[model samples]
Target: MNTKPRQTGRGGPRGTKNLPPAPDNKENIDTQILRLEQLEQKFNVEGSNTLDIVYARQENDQHHATIQAQAAELERLKEIVASFHASEGALGPNITPSGSAAAGSTQDAPKKDKARKHSAAANVDDMALDERASKGQIGAESQPSGKKGKAPKPSAPTNVDDMAIDAPDGAAAVAGTGADDEGVSDTTAALARENAELKRLLAAAQAGPVGGPAEEGPAPGSIPRPKGSAGSDFNIQDAMGLGHGRKNRKNYKSIMRSCRDLVLQARIDWERPWAEVSAATKSKAFAVAEERHPILARFFNSWATEELMKQSVKNKRNRAYKHDGLEVPEKYAYLKANAAKRNPTAPRGRQAKLGRVDVARKRAEKKKKVATSSIKTKKDAKGKGKAVAPESDEDDVEMKQYAPSEEDESDCTY
Candidate 1:
């Protein structure tokens, strides 16, 4: 069979031409956002993404509502403009065309009163017609005069204190003239009452308790932050850090100190020495060692490790001093003495405790002791143990045997 490419329309998809044209970019973006929101709702992503999506949708809804309100207001304004235009068109000619005649006839005193009444009547008639048209009475007038709808008539206005009163212009004008000060006083009183209520509500919200007094609560937006709580404000960098599991850098020195204190406390509280109980209670806290709990084992192990590390460092430092042919510092003098004590042949005493400087002085003292012993021996030889000349054959033999050789005699003379 010969293979050939099947032709489709220029639109690229077979059934796409029948689909409604895609909206503008802004509308399409909104549609996509809505779809995404629905998807997010149906299959929620963990963490802050869900919260962000919700907040965005709420803001979008608020903006849309405000835009719709503004649009309705614009339409209402257009209708009012159209009504004003209609009224002006109907009344414009009557007012302007007769203006010059009225001015000239001002001298005709008798006709002036009639012209003024006609003008006043015309204005009243125009206002009445406008009001009737606005009130939807034009429909009533178009119906047959004899046929009236039996729809319930509007009841007379009530003068109850509970009901809000909407007085006509004449009534309102009369009230304003008669009780202007009273009206002003009432408005001020109402405003003051409203202000007090608002303050009370605000105080209650800040206080945290509904029944708590306003004075007891912290100032709004000024609540003291909880200790050890995470920060509220965050950024993209923080999100990245969280994704990778942010690390907390610890000061090992401080950690060692804290662990050491805890271990010491545990030992004291349990009334057992560290070495004796470490193996048995190593898996338990010192506080509750009898219970054999392992909660504090980690801390105990950390402290033990820190001690071992410290000993290792000390040994290394001592080795470094020896390698460099330098004397150990005074602080390490105790360690030097302790090591010497460990040897079986090492001498002990104040000299053992002495540092390198004192040990050198001790060597000089030993030399002086040898010189003093030699001086004592020479004095004893000259005074009490004097030599005698040989007289007998046996004495001569002894003399010959004990006497210094010729080489010793020469060395003695020197």
Candidate 2:
């Protein structure tokens, strides 16, 4: 509150009355800080969403790979069951009592089957021994030659087991299979040898196969290749030699070229979804291809023509896309082309179909909500919508008659 006049260094002191209030920049700075923070938060949110999508895609792929493996295993089991079923006689088969093969107590089936086989072998051996003895072959072969006196006419050694029981020295006769001085001993030795042979046959029968039973694998085919060789080419087509036909045509490479050329020349709608093709169209295309190149018919049938078309069309499309020239949408790309979506349960493996998964993709889809939905511009009259349907998908491209088209094309993204 000084009353004295203020003095300036050069010109006069500026008057306080002429000076404007100091400008406040705090509000502007605060607004700018808030905007920067909001932008940063938005960027973080977008990055997190992208990461989540990537993780989901990876998880989905893993699930699909696991399912594929399980499916292969199930197919193998099916083949084994079919083979066994075809081999097993319905009834009057193995001597394990009637209905035993199909009844309970499966745990004891192997043992019972072995016993049955052993008993059958023993019975056959008895029949063979009896037949030879009745023919007097055993007695003729075992007549003692060194005895000085006229040898007693050897009894036709029929039912040697009973003779072994009745003989005065039965223990000695049964104990040794070696030929000895007396004719009776020679006959006993021969019978003992036959018994030993029968035992050997029984043991071999019980042992199952020559090298012992082979393990039933997780899947069946040829022996699986070592896992270490997995990274190298193991394409099924190459392994199965799909490119090669019966002797007399061309070499593998030349045949491959011909196949490729044939695919390019074949008439197919490359733009249309594979599932959208009519059955007649598929067969016609295959027939036409077969007419042109008779050899292709050997490698594939009408049902498999789609595979050839896909390979050729997509391969050419990819080369064009690399140079940014003949590119098509991802959906139309050979590798990327999606088949028509089926029920979510369609891809489930055997175990998954049995409801064994921790979380079913189908059930989860049912639970999930699609937040992004567009307004429905058309609705069907309840009666007409359910009463009749279009003859073909082509005929109903615009939708049902009751559900008319509208200019505002609002769609829901599922």
| TM values, all candidates | 0.18, 0.20
Error of 1 at 403 (Å): 83
Clashing pairs in 1: none
| CA error at residue 135 for candidate 1, angstroms | 43
In model 2, the Cα lDDT at residue 9 comes to 57
> Candidate 2 versus the native: TM-score?
0.20
Which residues of candidate 1, in runs, are more than 4 Å off? 1-49, 96-414
Clashes of each: 0, 0
**Candidate 1 overall lDDT versus native:** 0.42
Where model 2 places Cα greater than 4 Å from the true spot, the runs are: 1-236, 239-267, 271-278, 292-295, 298-305, 327-414
Per-residue lDDT value at 20 in model 2:
82
Report lDDT (Cα) of residue 1, candidate 1.
Answer: 80
**Residue pairs in candidate 2 whose N, alpha carbon or C atoms collide under 3 angstroms:** none
Candidate 2, 219-247: lDDT as tens digits: 33332332222113343234334535644
